[model samples]
Every structure is written in structure tokens, then in C-alpha cells.
Target: MPRSHVALACLVAIFWGLNFLAIHASLEQFPPLFLVALRFTLMALPALLFVPRPQVPLRWLVGYGLGFGTLQFLGLYSGMAAGFPTGLASLVLQASAPFTVLLGAVLLRERLTARRALGIGVAVAGLVLVGISRGGAGAWWPFWLVVLGAFGWAIGNISSRLAAPPRPLELTMWMAIVPPIPMLALSLLLEGPRRITDSLADSLTAQAVPAWIGLAYTIVFGTIVGSGIWVWLMTKHPAGVVAPFSMLVPVVGITAAWLVLGESPHLLEIIGGALVVGGVLWSGRLVAARGAADPAGPVDVGDPGASAHAVEPAAR
Candidate 1:
């Protein structure tokens, strides 16, 4: 990657990190499921109109949508609404990285070396500490929901690997078309027509301006610009060179939440988040080193989400 691309990678990380604050803003005015529906609906329009459909099988695209777009955001938005902290949401969502490693080994039949195993174990331990910290407050369920979202993200990553679309960015866009209908149905079923109407009605008010802006930010920067640039960089550089920059996201997330949303994390959460980032970076580093040692190394796709975030450490 060129120095300019490196800066772009960091820019993507900042956009994604601040995306947590945007989600929180939207959730203040929109139902979580409904937000999921609307977010994707806004994104899906481009897919329907402008973006070419990825050449992968239909099932893979749908699976990518369901797992990455639908399930991941469903759990994520729901958890945030249930009072999961925003900074931590960014941290916990990273569980997808380790989950990807595990799923790749079991479902994809990829080899999991001892170093990878150690990394996963360390990451999981960090997660467990974070979970325990919340459990001490008897509000652990929301934490699990975010973790489930992370798992959903991992599933989406697997689907992306299987899809192996020639245009990964198009795959990202087309998958957006999957979430709106299902999530909207859920919103109608769970959030009710009255609430949906109320939320929409509320959107016109001056108080709702920030929420609308946040929504636009998420759709434009978070997905289109952020993920688009990520996939572009992935296509251009080795995954190892690209993957480490992703670690910056939580740093920005936590810092932004603290500064903007006034979210001060628990000591345990800080420690745990450190472990999670460090462990994931460690695992990614080992994978890159191994690949560097052997340029003929087989490709192993890894990721946070096909939407993640994009290019996995093992993709090289």
C-alpha cells in the first residue's frame, strides 16, 4: 500500500469508529429494527439502480445479506437499544475476527495453527472479562446480543469467502438489498405500525435533524465510502498490510464515545478491550508473518464482516 493508501485505510477506520455515535443518534429516534431496515433500504437503492450484481450465486449473496446485513445489525441495533454502551459495542463487535478464525477452521476446513489458537484464546478471554464485567451489573444479556452480532458478522465473512465474487464491493452493495424487507417485517411485527409511523413522523422535527444526519453519515461514510475504500484497498494490497489498520477502529470508537457521548468505560472493559485488540492484531501479525515467510502460501479468507470490513488477514 502506498502512503496515501495507508492514510485512506486510517480514514476508513475513523469513519467506522465514529459510526457508533451515528448509530446511537439514530437509535435515539428510530426503532432498532426499523433503523436496520431504513439504513439498508437507503443503501440498497444504489444496488438496485447503479451497482452491478456480483456474479456469485444468489444464495451466497442472500446469505451475505442475512448474516452480515440482517442478523448482524439486527442484534447490534437491538443491543444498543437495550442499553449496551456504544464504545463497548465497537469493541465487542470485533469478536467477529476471532469467530471468523474459528468458523474458518470448522466450516471451511482451514487449518488453525497453534499461534492462531492462542490468539483466539486470548481474544476470547478478553471477551469473557468484558462479559463478566457487565454480568456483575446483571445486565449481561445485551452484551451477549452484541456478541451474537459479532458472530453474525463472522458468518457473513464466511459467506463472502464462499461467494468469492469478482467484484467484492458490488457484493457488499447488493447484499444491502437483502436486509430491508426482512428487517422491516420484523419492525412491523415487533415495533408495530404505530411506532414506525411515530418514528417517521418524528423525523421531520428539528430535534430529529441530528438523527437524520447520523443516518446519512452511516449510509454514506460508514458503508459507501468506508467499505468501498476498504475493498478497493484490499484488492490492491496484501491483506496483512491492510488488516492491521482495522485495529484502530475501536480506539476511535471508544475515544469518540467518551468525548461525544460521555461514555467512560469500566476499568475491566478497558483492559478487556485492550486484550481484544492486541490479541486480534497478534493473530493477524502471525498470519502475515507466515505468509511473508512463504509467498506461495495458500489463500485463506478471514474478516470482520464481508462488510467489515473486508479483507481478512489470511486472504493473502
Candidate 2:
């Protein structure tokens, strides 16, 4: 890949990394569930109206929406609001890579390399380390919630693999259509209509300015623009060459949270986070090496919405 394209890939990582802070800001004023519903609602509108439907099956699209659109944000926003450190949430979500590989092996009968298995073990160990460090201090649920969100993201990766839509960005946009109604229903059931109404009513006020800005950043930059560049890069290069760039996201996330949010993570969390990123990068490097050596090997390293039984990019 050219240096310019590689930089574009890194740029996507930065956008997604900063997206965690955006979500944290948006959750300050919007109820987590309602925020999930609203995020998708706005995203789905332009896609449904102007974009052509992706040439994919309905079931896979629905599955993508449920897992990626609905379950992902449902756990992520709630977890962050529940006090999961933004930096840690970013770290934990990388677990989706191993989870996707594991699920693909089990559900899709995909074979895993020894390196893949080892990478997964290291990532899992990292999670355990973080869990022990946090749980020892009596704050554990938030960590688990983000893990659940990561699992949901893994599920989305699986559905995306199965779907294998021709136009990935269009498919991703259409997948947004599946989550709004269900998420809205969930918001009504859990957060209540009063909470939703109050959030909307307050949106016009000065207090909601930051929240709206955060939401716009998330929708435009995080998902749309970030995924757009990701898809374009994948089209221009081999998947293995392109996929490893996502590991940069957690690094960017941690730094952004620490700098902007004044978050200072414990040493243990930092160590564990390093292990997680190191493991994923180890696996990603192996993939890249394999692809370079054998042109016929697995070329499908999963991007945000384009893959088939491929590796995950911590697609948040």
C-alpha cells in the first residue's frame, strides 16, 4: 500500500478511537438506550432514502443490524454510562477480534491457526487481568458490560461475513435500518418515554450543545467517514495488509481519553491493555505475513462491514 493510503487507514483508526469520547459525551445528556435509537435513526434515514439497497439477503442484513447496530451500542453506551472507563472500554472492545475468530470456528466451521489460538489466549488473559484488577476493587459490572458489547460486535462480524455484500458501505448503511425500531422499543421499555421526550425537549437548549456535537461527530466521522475510508482501502489493497491498522484504535482511544477526559488509568489496566493490543497485532502480523507469502491464503481480513469468515477489526 502507498504511504498515503496507509495514512488514510490510520486516520480511520484515529476517528474511531476518538469516537469513544464522543459516546461518553453524548451519554451525558441522552439516555443510553434512547441515544442508541436516535443514532441509528439519523444514520438510517439518508441510506434508506438515497442509497440503493445492498444486494444481500434480508436475514444477514437483519442479523448485522441486530448485532452491530442494536446490541453493540446498547451495551457500549450503557457500559460507559455505568462508569466503565472510556480508555478501558476501548481496550476491552478489541476482544471482539478473538471472539469473532472463535465464533467463526464454532459456528462457521472455520479453521484457526496456532497463531490465532495463541493470540486469542493472550487477549483473553489480558481481559482476565483487567477483570481481576477492577473486580478486586469492587467495580466489575461496567467492565463486563463492555465485554458484552464486544461480544455483540463479534456477532456482527459473523453476520457481516455471512452476508458478504458487494458494496460494503451501502450494506453497512442499510444495516442501520434494522436497529431503530427495536432499540426504540427497548428504550421505551427500560428508559421510559418520559426520559426520551425530556432528552429531545432539552436538545434545543445550551446544555445539549456538547451532546449534539458529540452525536454528529460519532455519526459523520466515526461510523460513516471512518468506515468509508476503510472500505476504500480494502478495495485498493489486500485485506491482510489493511486489517492490522485497526489495532491502532485502542492506542488512540487511550491517549484521547487520557488527554481530553483527564483519565489516568491504573498501572495494571495499562499493562493489561498493552497485552491486548500486542496480542491482536501479533495475530494481525501473522495474517499479513501469511497473505504476503501465499497469495491464495485467506484474503478476507474483516473491515467494518466487508468480510467473509475473516478477522475482526474491533468494529465499534
Candidate 3:
């Protein structure tokens, strides 16, 4: 990879990392579902008009949308709104990688290698420690909700793989069409119409500036710019070369949360986060090794969607 492309990749990681803080900020002004609805609305408009629909069937698109857009963000935003810390949320969400592997073995009948099994075990242990740490801090419910979000993300990864669209980025943009109305309906049902109206109105207030800024960052930088650069890098380099940079996302997320949001994680949370990241990296290494060992096997390191599968944000 060119040094320029490497720099671009790092920039994408930074955008994605700071994305958690954006979610944390936006949740302060808009109800979780409502904010998510608006996010998809912005994502789908204009781009949906310009980008051709992916060549996949409607069922696949719908399934991907529901899993990635609706379920994933619903749990994530709600968990954040429920007081999940930005840094910890970033670390915990990495559970999606192992979750995706497990789901693939069960649903797609993919083989589970010993290395992957060991990685999964380590990740699960780290997750348990994280849960215990957070629970001790009185954030049990929100932590679980984020874990649910990670599972939704895993399901979405499978859905995307099943869809196998020729253009992954276009499919992602089109899937944006699926979330707004349903999420809005959910917001109305759960948050109540009155609360939704109040929040929408309040978004125009001075206090809501940060929220709106956060929304803009998510829509523009996080989704459009970050995904665009990721797709570009994938085209320019092997997926293995680009995918590891995604591990930096949690690093940036945790650091940004600490610096910008004044979030200081507990010592246990820090240790657990290290274990989780290490485990995920270990899993990824095994995948790369498998791909190398059998070039004609199922693993396709050049697949455009591989990076998305590994690190694509739910809100993204």
C-alpha cells in the first residue's frame, strides 16, 4: 500500500473511532430511535437518488437493512442513551467479530477452526470480565444492550455475505432506505409521539448544537467519507493489509472519549478491553492465515465487503 493510502486508512479509522462519541453526544438531544431514524433519512436521501440499487433480491436487502440498520442501531443507541460510556461501548461492540464467526458456523455451516475457537473463547472470557466490571459499576443493563447490538451487527454481517451484492457500498447506501420509517414508528410506540415531538423541537435550541454537530459528523464523515475511503483502500490494497487498521478504531474511540468526553474507564474495563482487542486481532490473524493456506478456499481476502464485515459501524 502507498503511504498516502495508509494515511487515508488511518483517517477512516479515526472517523469511525470518534463515531461513538458522536452517538453519545447526539443521544443527549434526540431520543435513541428518533435519532437513528433521522440518521438513515439523511443517509438515504440524495445518495439513494444517485446510487443505483444493488443487484441483490429485495429479501436480501430487507434482511440486511433490518439486521444492520434497525436492530443494530436500536440496541446501540438505546444502550448509549441508557448511560453506557462511549469508550466502553466501543470496546464491547468488538464482540461482533466473534459473534459473526459463530453465527456463520451455525447458519452457513462454515468450518470452525481450532484457532478461531480459541479466539472466541478468549474474547468471551474478556467479555465476561467486561460485563462483571460494568455490572459492578451499575451499568449491567446498558452493557447487555450494547452486546445485543453487537449480535445484531453479527447478523447483519451474515446477511451482507448472503446478499453478496456486486457493489457493497451501494448496497449499504440503499439499505439506508429501510430504517427510517420503521425506527420512527418504534420511536412513536416506545418513546411516545409527544416525547418525539418535544425532542425534535428541542433540537433547534442552543443546547442542542452539539447534538446536531454530532449528527452531521455521523452522516458526513462517519458514513460517507469513512466508507468511501475504506472502499477506495480496499480497491488499492489487499483486504488483509487494510483490515488490521480497523483495530485502531477502538483505540481512537477510547482515547477520543477520554479526551473529548472526559470518560475515564476503570482499570478492569481497560484490561478487559485489551483482551477483547487482542482476541479479535488473533481471530483476524487466523482468518488471514486460512486464506493464505488455501487460496481457492472460501475465504476471499479481496472481497470488498470484508472490511465492512469486520468493522463497519452499525450507525454507519
Candidate 4:
């Protein structure tokens, strides 16, 4: 990869990694779902207005958007709201990488390799370790919701691969537009208009600065810049190089949570986070090194056995 592209990739990683903190900060007052809906609503602005719509099948577009944008966020935010800690959520969501690998096997008829399976095992073990340690910290069920959200994101990954939108940034932009409606509907159904209205009202009156900062960080830094840079990076390099950086999110997540919220990880959680990051790194290096060795091989991404290609084009 060119130095500029590498720099861009690193920047995207930083933005995304910092996003865990952004989510934590935002969830302070905003109901997770409502906050998420507000996030997408804010994100859709310039994209809906300025970005050209991509030409793709409507179902693919809708499915990709809702699966990734709505369902994934719903599960993640709800999980966090229910009790899953920020650092833990960061670790569990990496399951989406392995989930995408499995999804590719089933949906795209992609082959699974032993090494990738091993990486998955390591990552899962790490998650289990973290979960066990955190058992007393919160409800287990919500953490499962985050896992489900990872699965939903994995589904979106397969859908994106199948769709292969001609214009990835445009696709991302349009896809981003899909979340606000469903999230709004969910918020209305679950929280009721009264609660949401009260939250918003409170924000306007006294001040919900954390919510504002969270919303701004997610909308501006997380979605727009992060997704845009990711799409651009994929255009310049192979997916394998891009996917591994995702593991770093938890590093930033844990550190930021500790700094901002005084949320500390237990020894087990720390050890688990290390294993998860190592697994992801091992998976990434495996593919990248393999691709370098094979003269005729095209680089791949998403597969621990291979590389991560599922969201290669959307790593941001």
C-alpha cells in the first residue's frame, strides 16, 4: 500500500476505534435506540443530499442498509443499554469478522480453512473469558444481543459482497439512510413517544452535553469520515490489510472508557481482550502473508483462513 493510503487506513482505524468511546459517551443520557436513530438521522444529511445514489438492486440496497445499519446498531446499542460494558461490547463485536467468514461459506459458497477456524476459536475463547469475568458486572443476556448484532453485521457483510455495488461510497451513503426510519420505529415502539420526547426535551432544557458530543462524534467522525475513508482505502489496497485493524477498536475502547468513564477492565477481561486482538491479528497476518507468497493469488479479506473480503470495500 502507498504511504498515503496506509496513513488513511490508520486514520480510519483511529476514528472507528474511538467510536466505542463515542458510543459510550452518547449512551449516557440518550436511550441507546433513540440515540442510534438520532445518529443515523444526523449521518444521512449530506450523504442523502450530496452523494449520488448507487445503481444496485433495490433488495440488496435495502437489505444491506437495514441489516447493517438498523439491525446491527439496534442489537449493539440495546445490548449496551441492557448492561453490556463498552470494552466488552468492543471485543464481542469482533465476532462479526468470524461470523462473516462463516456467512461467506454458506451464502457465497466460499471455502473455510483450518487456520481461519483456529482464529475463530481463539477469538471466541477470548470472548468467553471476558464474559465470564464480567458476569457479575451486568446481565449476560444483553451481551448476547451484542453478539447477535455482530451476526447481523456479518449478514450485511455477505450481502455487500453479493451486491458489489459499483460505487461503494454511494452505496454506504444510501445504505446509511436506511437506518433512521427503522430505528425511529423501534424507538417509538419500545420507548414510546413520551419517553423519547422527554429525553429530547431534557436535552434542550438543561443540557445533554454528552449526548451532543456522542451524536456529533458518531455522525461526523464515525460514519461520514470513517466510512468514506474505508471505502477509499479498499479501492487502493486489498481487504486483508484493512480488516485486521478492526481488532484495535477494543484497545481504544477499553482505554477510552477507562479514561472518560472510569470504567476499568478486570484482569480476565484484559487478558481476554489481548487474546481477541491477537486472534484477529493472527488471522490478518495469515492471509496477508499467504497472499504475498502466492504469485497468482488475489488478496482476500474477512476470512481468518484467507483474508477479510466481506467488508473490505467498506472497512471504514
**Best-matching candidate per lDDT:** 1
Any residue pairs clashing in model 3, and if so which? none
lDDT of 1 by residue, 147-172 (tens): 88988877776776666667778988
Clashes of 3: 0
Deviation (Å) of 104 in candidate 2: 2.2
* Stretches of model 3 off by over 4 angstroms after superposition: 1-12, 225-247, 286-316
- Alpha-carbon shift of residue 308 in model 2 (angstroms): 4.9
* lDDT (10s digit) by residue, model 2, range 56-155: 7787778878887888888888888888888778887776667777776676555566776777678778878988888887778877888888878777
Estimated TM-score per prediction? 0.86, 0.87, 0.82, 0.85
Per-candidate Cα RMSD to the true structure, in Å, reads: 4.8, 4.6, 5.5, 4.4
Ranking by lDDT: 1, 2, 3, 4
Counting only residues 3 or more apart in sequence or on different chains, how many pairs clash (N, Cα, C under 3 Å) in candidate 1? 2
Better lDDT candidate (1, 2): 1
- Residue 41, candidate 1: alpha-carbon lDDT: 97
Scanning candidate 3 in windows of ten residues, the lowest lDDT window is: 307-316
Residues 245-292, candidate 3: write the lDDT tens digits. 555678899999999989998888888877776875676575545545
